[model samples]
Structure formats: structure tokens, C-alpha cells
Target: MTRDGRRGEAADDPVDDATLALLLEVAGTPKPGNVDRRRDLDDLRFEAFLGGAVGARPGLERAARAADPGAPSVGDAFVRAVEGMAARAGTNTQFGCLLLLVPLVRAAADPDRELSPDALDAVCRATSVDDAVAFYRAFEAVDVAVDDPPPGADDLDVRRGSDAEPALRERRATLRDVLALSVDPTDPDRVADRNAAEWTEGFPRTFRAAEWILTDEGPLADRAARAFLGLLAAEPDTLVASTLGAEAAREASERAAALLGVDSEGPGGVGDVDAIPTDAVHGADLDTAESLAERFISEGINPGTTADLTCAALFVALRRGAEVAP
Candidate 1:
């Protein structure tokens, strides 16, 4: 997309816009755990992520254009985009982000590029069984790290990948059906995520984050970083719970809350004395944040769900005409 207030100029094509969002998510400072522009995991480098974002751009655009009226379903677009990303990055860099973006892109593909919670809901609610099948195929394409299915869904374990395709067909489950398993009321302990919540319900958090990004006074990167911290403080990241235990996730949330000087599960607390922007306060906050990031990174605790939510927020801001810097 063109810089904000330049609506008269032709916006970046859908591919370019999606690519920029991916880059911005990884490039955000103090976005602990996940690979950013300055941090790299042993197997995943920042350069590889940039390549994966570039590689997935065309597929994301094609998915957007294909679903303008309706052709490729979100599931099909998701599988294709992840495949392209994996081929370039040689690892799973953006599978979770792609899950959120395929639907967002479809909703934004209208003549006006208008995206609302209702529009996103309609797009997801319209998913077909074929979309479910394609989603399973996408899971097979990459070894995505996910929480295990509940006892009831043991047969439909994602680790089985295409092996579960036969059962998915036998059950005639739609993409919505598959996602419902994650957030099912029967299995209260199952880890529900913002992505699955978006797929099953409307994307409440994603839309709210976007609104915060729009209203917050700062450059896009600062807004994104603060939003990331805000969300992390407010919610226990499901990815952390999935990889570690619930207690670890809770601790992570508490740490994030302390960083921003807010009560866990409370508001952003931007004006709190603990959150003041004094040089000493800022330095101590970064020191604390860096310490937490170092501990998580060393322990392999990646709050990926938080990262994915940030990407969805970035996508919304860009689609709604936020100015991005080079």
C-alpha cells in the first residue's frame, strides 16, 4: 500500500501489500521470542523469513483475487501460501500468519478494499468441506507446531496429516468443523487460539488490535510493538501453553504485564507511572524486556500466537491505509 494519505495513488498490489505486512511483523523491535529483523533462531534466520514473505506474496495475491467473487476458498489459499513459504524458507515461518491472512485478503479484495468484522465472519462461515480438506493438506505440507487435539479428536490429529484425510472425508467436516474441535466446549482444556477463534467465531481480537493500531499515536513500528506487548500482557499466549505448560504461559503474560505496568488482563496502562517514558524508566523497561526475551529464547518458548495476532493487526492497519516507512 502507498503511504497513508496517498489514497489517490494506486495502492501496492495485493501481493506487495501482504509482503510488507509480513516484513513489518518480523521487523518490529522488542517483539520477543519470534524471529524478528535482529533476532534469529538456530534453524530460522531473519533472511529466510524475508525470503519466505517474498515467496508467499504471489500466492497471497492470487488467493485475494481468486476469492474476490469466489473461486479458491480460504483453505486452498492457505495451503498454497504456506507451501510457497516453506519452499523458500525451508521451514515453517508464517503458517499461522497465513491462516489469518488468507481470509483477510479475501475480505479486502472488494472494490473499496473495505474490511469489517462482519465481512471477515461471512468469509469464514462460508467455508466448504473442501476447505477443510485443503487445510489438512496444508498442515501436511509443513510441520506446523500446534497443540494436540483432544481425546475426541485423536483420530483427527494434525500430526497424522494426510493420514487423517480419509477420516475427515468420512465425517464430512468443514473447515469450521475442524476449527470447532480446537475451541469445543466439551474439551474445556483444549487450547483455543486467536486464529481458530477467528475461523470459528468472528475475529474479535484482530479487529480490536487493528483499531488500537489506528488510534494509537506513533509510527507504525512503535504502534505494533506496543500493541504486541499489550496483547501479550492481556492474554496467556496459547502457543506458549502448547509448547510449555499453562503455568509458563501465565508467567509470560505476567512478565509482559509488568513490563507495561498494567494489571494482567487489564488495559494498556499507557499513562501509568510504571509506563512513563523517562530515560531511566525506558532503559529499565528494555532491560527487563530483553531479559525476559533472553530467557524465553534460551528455553525455546515462542509466543507464536501473539506474533500471528500482531500480523493480522498489521494487515488490517495496512488495508485501512496506514503509512509504512522504508
Candidate 2:
């Protein structure tokens, strides 16, 4: 169903689904340290996200036109989307979300393919050095919160933006190749880049959480908030790690896991939201989640990478026919 409760009206339109996903992600309240309908960070307003979603549509349209002749490549679409999103929001609002969405949108554009991890993987793998250059240009559009590159990879640092273009060309790196660098942590104390991991590892968390959202009954916004919590609890947020260190990121995840009444230990490791029974996340859990949201906001511990994953999951859920009725 569409946002207005119309079934199948825009079901075939990946651009519409992707745009709605962005709006719905931010609309989910108590998302904990992220912008939502009921809360705002000091630097980012709820309205800014709305503007970013609107601005991203043209690029999404480009992605959805992938089967057509002269269509933009995945990285080109991503760069255009990031540029438009930043222009409208006056800052970087959905850079990470666009990073995930563009490939999924491109994959969904193919008439012969269904949107899945394998399809997304193929789309990512097909990118070229030109795509890598376009991706680096996206970094110059706005300030994205990413960790510094590992030792001796300074020429490939994302913050170098277009300046890294020559190096990327010299190395003949594809967009996937650039993303591969951040997929895993170099040290025991560091947290892996969750967004990059999704890109290189076929979006395991996004697909898993999308299934969670689709199967659960309730308003989509509430389901999104729950999925947000689940993804955050499952792993430490990469953005949190970049800004607040690995320990602080783990602490945030543990706190979320505790709110869901799950043991933060054992085989799945700490804060596995999947371990908690589905029905257990109600009433008291939500109340505690609200409190946690407030605390995370006050402390400036935003789990932004988790939010980005939730947005990608929402896109998948929408494409899979998750109802958007209020």
C-alpha cells in the first residue's frame, strides 16, 4: 500500500517507493538520537530531512531509468542525489541512505530482476572506475560523518573528495573496490563500517530487518522505529564509532538491548535484538526506549549509521509490499 493507503498504485515505481522510504524513516518517532516527527537534533531539523527526500527524487528517477538508453550509472545517480539532497537540506541529511538506496533502486529498475541481495550485489559489482570517481565526488557535496582511512590509505580518504580522483583512476578502482576498504575493522578496538559492510557483503542487515518490518503488524512508522532499535541493538553504529569511539558505540547498543529485555551476551553476542521475543517490545519497552532516546540526544550520541540501515530496510519493505497505512 502507498502512503495514502492506496494499494498497487505506485508499487511498480521504485522512485516513489524509495522517496517514501526516506520520509517514513524520519517519520518514525523515538528513533533515538536521530531526527523524527517528535524530536530534532540541534543541528538537524525534521523538516530538513523532508526537503532532502524531495530533492533526492530526480536522482532516484535516474536510477529507476536504468534500463533506458543513456541512463546514469549507479554512482552517477548517487552523486546527483547527494548533491540535490544537500542543496535542499543545506547540509548532509541522507548521504548514507542514498549510498544504500541508489544501488537498490538501480537493481529494482531491471524488468527481469527482483530486488534482492544478489541483484544488488550484481549492480554494485558492475560499477567501473568512472563510477568510483563519481562516488568520490559525492563526498564533496556535503560533510558526511566517516572515520579516517586506515594507515597508508591517505590518498584514498573520502574526505579528499574529488582530489582522490586521480588516485582512484590510477588504481583502476571501482565503486565496490573503494567500499571494500571499510567493510572490516583493521584492529580489535575499531568498529567496522556498517554502511560499507552492507555494500560489500550484500546488505545482510538491511534484508533481515526488512523482513522483520514486513512480517510485524502495526503502523509502518512504529514498525520502522522498532526495526531501528533492532538494528542498533544488533551492532554498534559506525557513525557513533567514528564520532564517539568503539566503546561508546557498544555502550549505546547495549543500552538499546537492555531496553528490549534481552541478555547482552552469549552466541549472538551483546545486544542482539533478534533474541528478544517480538511481543516483548511493547508498553514498558517503548517507554524505556523513549527515555533512552532522550538520553542519547542529550549526550550527542546519535546512532546515524543504524538510522541509515533502517531507511534502506524501509525501502526494501516498501518494495516488498509492506503496507504504509496509518
Candidate 3:
């Protein structure tokens, strides 16, 4: 029970945390080069995205329920939810977010509500080969852009879409196994996005983002915006790096850090530096962030990985009993 003696969760409604966070994420303005209340991509509209998120609520809830101890494997929930969402949205709106949130929702909805690192890892580790197949099926349902497959991995080609499912079965690869192979440890030249890395490392960044959201103040959207910038500033967006290049992604992160007047090193690094002007974003002015957003959109630079992290943070916040802003 919450302090108000009501059942504690993201909301009282039947809708689950994944759907709610997705809705809130798309609705957040000044999100920088992503579709939000303030802007929309030429091919996608804000309302369409909102409708898609709401439409996927049932599947997200089911996925959460499926994650309960002794219940069915939870990975299929992601595939079903994404399939349902693709049908509704007609595009790749929330695939990455879905990937991050399904496990979180499962952990949150546990009978004990034991939302912890260990619990989340357990949920991820429990995934089966069926979950891996479902994940590829979800990929087939959308046109999500990603880096090219490393050489010598013909069956792992994501572009193969559903065709890759058969190969997955032959290898008996689970969702975790797929992620492990996504980023080759031997290749120093290759880079994996935080999302993919999370699957292998047990989602440290998502949990850390959630922890930041819990301690953050201000409206949820503002907190989300800040978190988004922080994530980008700290790490180059893998989606951007893959679709564009490593240098482009690094520049995007540097620009975000400059806008927020923070650095990858630590908080308030820019402000504390004597060289940067006092008028710099020491206070993290909202207008400066918006300005950076406009520049990013114009430059065709989208920090999608950062946005995914924000949604993960929002899910963590809502799940941990932080009151949502009206």
C-alpha cells in the first residue's frame, strides 16, 4: 500500500507501466529531434504515436502479468506487444522502449513487488529461445534501422527479418544469446548501443536512470528531458552512431553536454570550469535545451538511444512510487 493506503503502482487504471511510460515519453516536449508534443517527424504524427501507445496497453499489461513467478516466459509478451503496436502505429514507434520496459514491468508486477537489480536480472535471465524468436518477429514487424551485421554472421542479419527465425532455432539461441552475439567482444572496432549492452550486462544503465529519476525533482517531463540529455551527454547514441557514424554520434553527445552545461566527467563540469562563460547553461535553461533540439532536428541527428533511456527512467520512477505529474 502507498502512503495513501491505496494499492501502489504506476496508476490505478488497468494500464501497465510500459504503456504509460511510452505515452508519457512520446508526449514529452523539447525531447530533442524525437516526436513529441512540440514537434513531429514528417512521416509520423504525435497523435498517431499516442494512439499506438494506448493501443498497446493490453499487450503490455499481459506481458507484465506473464512475468510473474511460475507464469509463462515473458519475452513473447514483448513480441506480441510490438506486433500489436506495429499494427496500430504502422511504424517503428516503441520497439526499443518495449524491449527495455517489458522486463521492468514484469519485475514491478511481481507478487512481492520486489523491484531490484537482482529481480530484474532474474527476469531477463529466464527468457527462452521462444522469446528470442518472438523478438525477431517483432523486428520483422517494423522497419527499425540498425548497424550492419559484422562480417561472418549471415544468419544474424536483422534485415533477414522473419527469415532469421529458422536460424535462431537451429542455434537454440535465447533473447540473451542474441544480444550477446549482437556485440562481438573480440571486435574493438564495433560498438553496441546501451540497450543491447543492457541485455548482456543486466541493464545497469536502465536501473541507474531509474534511480536518477527517483531522486530528480520537477515535473516528470522536465525530469525526463534532463535525463535524456544526461544520457546522451554521457554516452554516444548507438542508434545515431550506427545509422550515421561514430564521429557523428560523439558530436551529438558533445553538443548535448554543451547545451546542458554538464560533461561526461561529472555534474556541473562546464559551470565549474573557469573558461566557460557565466551565461553558459550552468542552470540548464529550458530555452537552451530547446535550441539544441532544433539544431539536432535540422541536422538529421536523432539520439534515439537517449530517448529509450528516458522512457526506462520514467518507468522506474512511476514503478517506484513517484507521483506522476498531471
Candidate 4:
């Protein structure tokens, strides 16, 4: 039970004290609920990307897929085909989300994305809320209600303007810019504008951050894997065996650390959130989208771990036209 006597299991995992500290840092933040202000763009990307097969697209679905290709590995061929469609579709969020899911679209991707121990942390960092949502729309199913409330209720507080419409109008604003790649990639001014757009409307910054984490010594996988494992609650041994190659004991220690707030080190905790440098963000972006997504997923994106709601939202927005994932 929470301090208020309500019940909450507080997300957990089995890892060393230090590792658990990092895991909790990513998972224990105060997330936006059904009626909250959070947004899980990372999880959204993963969900949308992994949700379905790209081949679901009728006529284009079976151009090269042989019903019985006696190849040693069909996964590569399938991924190549999906990646082709994604590139042709271009670098837009919708397309990017499709690209990340290329492996999944062809078949049941080894839920692990083939991450070796050397790349485990890198890939996890790679999968933060920001980048994950962009290319994983089909796999999206993270739950968050950023949708504007019914008109005239007049109770919302996020907006400070007299009229709620204008205060948070941009939240619901339609995706306006035409999808066009820049001709001058090296132009500083153009790059600034592009960067500016990405903070509020574009997802490049978030994706880049995720990409960095996935490739560097980041904590994306631990955050994602733990949340996924616990949410599924499918027996840690089985889950770890299938995914982490054997690390169930690590989850318990991590869970304890997350709840205790001992050495937490990410944006979800108040310390990490506050630790975010103002100059670093430069008045351009909002809070970390991945922080919100990871928190929400652990909290229960939809009372289940098999799917993610954020990914679903990305899919819905793309289908409706938002240029790409959240």
C-alpha cells in the first residue's frame, strides 16, 4: 500500500545495488496516469514497430516472400525487404517507426533484438522512450491520455491561459509541416530551425538521445527489460532465460533499490529530473519522453506486459498523419 494506504507494488528487478539504483532511476518516476501529463514516446515507438508485420500491406506484402524458401535464414531477407519499404517511405517518424520494426514485421524477432552482453546496455540505452516510439508504432501500446478533454469542462490545469484552447492548443495541433528532407544538412541556421522544430514537434532529439543510450554505456535495456519482465510477471526465471540469457537474481536487487531510491540515476526521480541542466535543454524541449514511457510501461500500459500502449498511439497518429512516431 502507498502512504495513503492505496496499493502499488512499486516496480522491481534483480540486479546489483549499483545496477538496481540505475534501474529504479529509470522506472520509479511519477508518471502521467490515465488522467496525467506524461507521454511515453519511446515505448510507443517500440510497440508500433513490433505490433504487426509490415507485410500486412496486401499487394506489396508478398512480392518476394517465398512460401517455402529453403534458405538458412529467412530473417535477413525479410528484414531487408521491410527496410527497403521503410527507406522508400523515407526518414519521417512514420517511416522510422516502420524501419525499427523491420525485423519484427518479417517474423517473431528474437524479442532481444540480438543484443550481446557487450551491446546489451547499449541497445537498452538505444531504446529509450523517444526513439523507441518513432520506429515502433505497430509495437506501440503504451497508455497515456494527452488527448484534450471535452470542451467547456474548464477544470484542466496544465494550461495557464484563460481559455484552455490556446494554453495547450499546440498539444492537439495537427502535424503541419510538409515532410521534406533538408537540402542543406550543413547549414547551421537550417539545422537550428530543424533542431528547434524537433523539441516541441519533431522527435529527432529524443530519438538521438535513445540512439546514444543504446550505443553508449546507457541504461535503456535494463529499464525496458525490467519493466517488460515485471509487467509480464511470467516467472523471472523463464523471462530471464528467454531474454537476458540468465539474470533473474539481478531483478530482485534492482527492485529493492528502485523502491528505496538508493543511488537512483535517471530522469524519473526528482533528483535526476532536477539534475537536468536548464542550459542543456535550452528552453526548447519538454521533459524526457522516454522517462514517461518507461515509467508508464512498468506501471501498466494496459494491465499487461505483452503489449505497449505508447507504440499504439504512435501508430494511430501516423495512420492519422503526424509525420512519424511520437
lDDT of 4 at 118: 26
Task: Give the winner by TM-score: 1 or 4.
Answer: 1
Worst 10 residues of 4 by lDDT: 11-20
User: How does each model score on TM-score?
Assistant: 0.87, 0.94, 0.87, 0.23
Q: Rate the local accuracy (lDDT) of all candidates.
A: 0.73, 0.85, 0.70, 0.26
Query: lDDT per residue, candidate 4, 1-326, as tens digits?
Result: 32212233321111111122222222422222211123334334322322223322321132213224542122233233334434433321232222222222222112332212222223222222222222122222221122122344233321222233342244332112111111122432111122112222323222323222222222333323323222222111211222322233234223322433333342112122223222222221113433543554454432211122122222222222222111
How does model 4 score by TM-score?
0.23
268-300: candidate 2 lDDT, tens digit per residue: 225443464555444225666788999999999
Best by TM-score: 2
Residue-wise C-alpha lDDT for candidate 1, range 1-326, written one tens digit per residue: 34333364446445556777788888876677877766898888888878889778766976778434556677778888988999998888988888888888887775554578887887888887788888888877677777777777787887887788888888988888888777643544434565787777677767767766776655676677666776677666778878886667767777777786665433322312223232222223544676777777988878888888888888888777776753
- Quick one: how many clashes does candidate 2 have? 0
- The full ranking of all candidates by lDDT, starting with the best, is 2, 1, 3, 4
- Which portions of model 1 miss their true places by more than 4 Å? 1-6, 66-70, 185-190, 265-288
Off by over 4 Å in 4: 1-173, 176-201, 217-268, 271-326
Cα displacement (angstroms), candidate 3, residue 314, comes to 0.4
Off by over 4 Å in 3: 2-15, 67-72, 184-189, 264-283
* Best prediction by lDDT: 2
